[model samples]
Target: MNGEVLVGILGGVGPAAGLVLHQEILRNTLNDGTDQGHLDVVHISRSSDMAARPAYLAQLEAGETTADDDHNAIENPAYGMARSLSMLVLAAEARSARLIVGVPCNTFHASPIWDTFAALVAAEHADHVTLLHMLDEAVAMIGRLAPHATTIGVMSTTGSRRARIFHDRLEPAGYTVVQVPDHVQDALNDSIYNTEWGIKSTSPSIHPRAVQNFQSYAKLLAHMGAQVAILGCTEIPLALTGSEIYGMLLVDPMVALARAMVRSAAPAKLVPLDIKLPRDVHLGKPKRTLSVRSDSVDLTDACETLR
Candidate 1:
């Protein structure tokens, strides 16, 4: 563990979501081990129940915390997610983690969740625990990867769409967002909740049908003039890794967030040149920089690919 920094993952909102983010963080932490050894990460694989909309609403509407209330069972989505976040930070702190990053993007983009997280973290007053709006990172990526695009495609959870995370974030910045049509949106919902793209699906690999359906939407969005698609939900990108749809680059918020983790937490000596990302991003070691595009993406060619 690096004495100066420790990064924590707030995952398991979906079974695979946190784990995939954990692996990505792990691989980035590989290559040149740090003096402190591998980058330390605390992962709390939360129960899917925590993200259950119906139960969460039932609990929220039931009102006011009681001694009997189990946060894990009855928490509002945001509250439960925030509760997990704080606990992980506490764990990371014990290990001398100077920074903590929440993953799966949904927790950050969801309504009241972001608001609640802000309120909760403020109460803690720990500057070391870090949280960035994934929407903002996605926007920055669009500016670089599809600089001229006036409209971008977005496919995410029903809750995220209702919250308007993409529209609210993008429209204000002078960009138009192309929302998936209802039928396309239904397909998306199944891919995330009912199919292999879903956390409930056990296997890490997305099924061919799910992949094919996802690409169909990509093609549709492209025909609609959306040049880039933002995998707004953290779960979406996990399926699309190494698969670029109709040549449209995907702006994965997790990847951007991971890049942020490297820049903010990794020790200065280990970071090496921005373009020449050192192998051991955490531990103090030197190896050839893996070449990925320098633009906001610091990932290597083998990892962060557009195709």
Candidate 2:
């Protein structure tokens, strides 16, 4: 255990979402069918430690928080994330020499929030933890899963979409990005944030309405000729747990992030992409076709294919 590299998760963007990421790490890992064979992982999820990601982004965009207002820790979700990351870093370092961490929240990855959190990590926890970019990993997964796919659809929170998180990344990479119109986005948001049935509110047991809304919105993206759809929000995968929607391949960035963390910590322990996915791991089928061999493909190869 002392010689092992630990996988760290900066969780609590939403508690259930964080647990799903932790589960994905375990699911994607190549274990010896025993608890001991699994990689060491440190998952810290103090939901209260962080402000709501969407609310924070909304505030930033509304000019509720200014560029120079570094003193407002309560309004800035980044400070909370950095603090959680520090705890994660400290915990991971006490157990291993190296730590690879991934934050599961897509909205948190928006520039205003991510840049601030990243700076804090670089200043304090940089030497202790290597944070993986969830969006980049997901984009690369699309490349690996569909090398010829040129149009990518994204389903995320209003904050993430408003922040142009996926747009800023995918458009520059030469892929056409598809998103729902405002009304559709509102329905999409309801599926994840609605108090009565939102995935965030009732995860581990999805409401049928939430699933319908997600599939409905995804079909809209398919109508726009999207060959692939990214479940950009961390809570989204729970609501849409299928490999494809309307012939569009559904790719979860969290899965990519988990696989990447395992690769970085211990490539040999990383499971082959083609391995039978657990019931909830959702990639349509384990035997689906691939441009790269399931046995040979790794995160680096996937990202390179995109380039």
Candidate 3:
């Protein structure tokens, strides 16, 4: 439980998600109200080099893995992610000798991407690095927050939904998962993929259209009798940064991963489970148009503001 374990945040999976995870880690770490008491964290965001995860998955689904065509030859996004993460592990070994890393992007955690990334990391750096599984962390949080919950709803990108990320994990744990129908899912996809106002493009400043779209999706999940909803997509939380939606509790995987990182590195430093750090609650503007710099926002200060 050495607090000195270097925590690594893999960015570029939507830069906003990594930033939010970093804030959550800092907010959930127990410090003596001093900068020196905080855990050492390294955030690596190499977005430009990484391919779009959804695009890669879609192509893979269409049987496009062979190198016969240049388009099919595009490297898997996981390779870039693993390469960056391996560099972080090397740096961590040089510094603290121990590391725990978290990737904030949900789509990246889908099997098609995550399996390769994990194997590559484990092949070389497994001895020194512990990669926290974001989905498992979220599911564990659901169990803690709602021990008796039966049906779970998931809000994720089209790629993640197609990958059955949440369903694979939750179903085996005795919980039923409810996802949007294909047509409704298309609207959900638009909320995150529409170039003009999608959460990926407009994060830290959600558009009214994005907000309204997610709201309607949450209502649909509620009507489907979901007892709780998992904001499976990292960007979805940016739009719906609340603990509940339409009476069902919402779970943020980024927060869950952050907490797990703290626990893995320094158990004693982990914040109490009951004192949940509100996710991205510091947006200064009204809900209709949330515009604020996430980098400058402190979750502790935001928690006080909420209180």
Candidate 4:
């Protein structure tokens, strides 16, 4: 790539979402006998904490009244989203990136919030910084992939449980949305918030029961006339990676987003950029003494040096 591209991820909506974005970026870049061809990412992982807001919203949607303190403890999705957009604009300006992308598929909060976020980026008027939204890309891709399909089921978080977010955008293109029932919706929320997406889990296995729950839910939607099922939440894809859930074509929003990024960035060679770590190293956390190496060198020599 002639010009450097900086991907601004408003992550931390959940750790799983952030990790998925990173993995997608890595998957897009093709190794071309070079060190760096993958798009540079300036990821802000703190936003994942905003997931609490959605969980709170789910309770309210369920007709349960919550205390102000409980509400206030969670980050306002609107404010968190705005902050994330601002961060992306600032990063683009500072880094002189050619493009900026935000990966928030659960479009709850408010519609005007997205407009405001767009306006903020437009005000910067950075010629090279093209702001991209994952939801729009995903919707468009699904349309092209399943043109004849009528009803599509969406599996997203409680925050984005509203049908308008997907239907408002997809209906005009001649598609209808079918979502999980309220009870099943609650189960999905628990699976993600308590087990996969949340930090409280002691044993975070894939949880076969969760998969069966989702599969059963998908079948129900299919029985209700949904031609395809869209895995709206980022965490759902990780859970349903290899399993074959019958009764509808399964579509993953994250996978759609990745395909869009690759198609959009075509002709720009992608190369793997591996950041070596100790066997037990964890990402984004500090470690003890360490060595850094680029992709262009021989690891054998580096190992000898370390020895």
TM-score of 1: 0.73
- Please give, for residues 1-307, the per-residue lDDT of candidate 4 as tens digits: 2465666667766655666766766665674645565666777766554546455455555656544346544433545655665666677667555655666445532343455456655765446556666767667756665566788788776667753566666678778787766766786767666745331241224555555555556666655677777777766654554312444666666655655565555546533223343332211111111122112212343233323
lDDT score of residue 223 within candidate 4: 59
* Every model's TM-score: 0.73, 0.85, 0.85, 0.70
Model 3 C-alpha lDDT per residue in residues 55-149, reported as the tens digit of each score:
88888788867442465466788888987887897778677558889998888888878898898888988777899999999888888767778
Estimate candidate 3's alpha-carbon lDDT, on a 0 to 1 scale: 0.78
> Between candidates 1 and 3, which one is better according to lDDT?
3
Tens digit of lDDT per residue, candidate 2, span 89-140? Answer: 6777676667788888888888878888788888887766788889988887
Candidate 2 lands at a TM-score of: 0.85
TM-score of 3: 0.85
Q: Which has the higher TM-score value, candidate number 3 or candidate number 4? A: 3
Model 1, position 74: C-alpha lDDT score: 50
Model 4 TM-score on a 0 to 1 scale = 0.70
Put down candidate 1 lDDT per residue, 1-307, tens digits, no spaces: 3556767777766666677666655545534665455666677877753666534434444664433247455555666667777787777767665765765655346555567667777778456677766677668756654567677788777667766767887888898788667755866777777844452362455555555555566666666667667777665654554424555656677666655565566644233323321231111111212222111212233122223
- The lDDT for every candidate, in the order shown, is 0.60, 0.75, 0.78, 0.57
True-structure RMSD for candidate 3 = 8.2
| Total backbone collisions, model 4 | 7
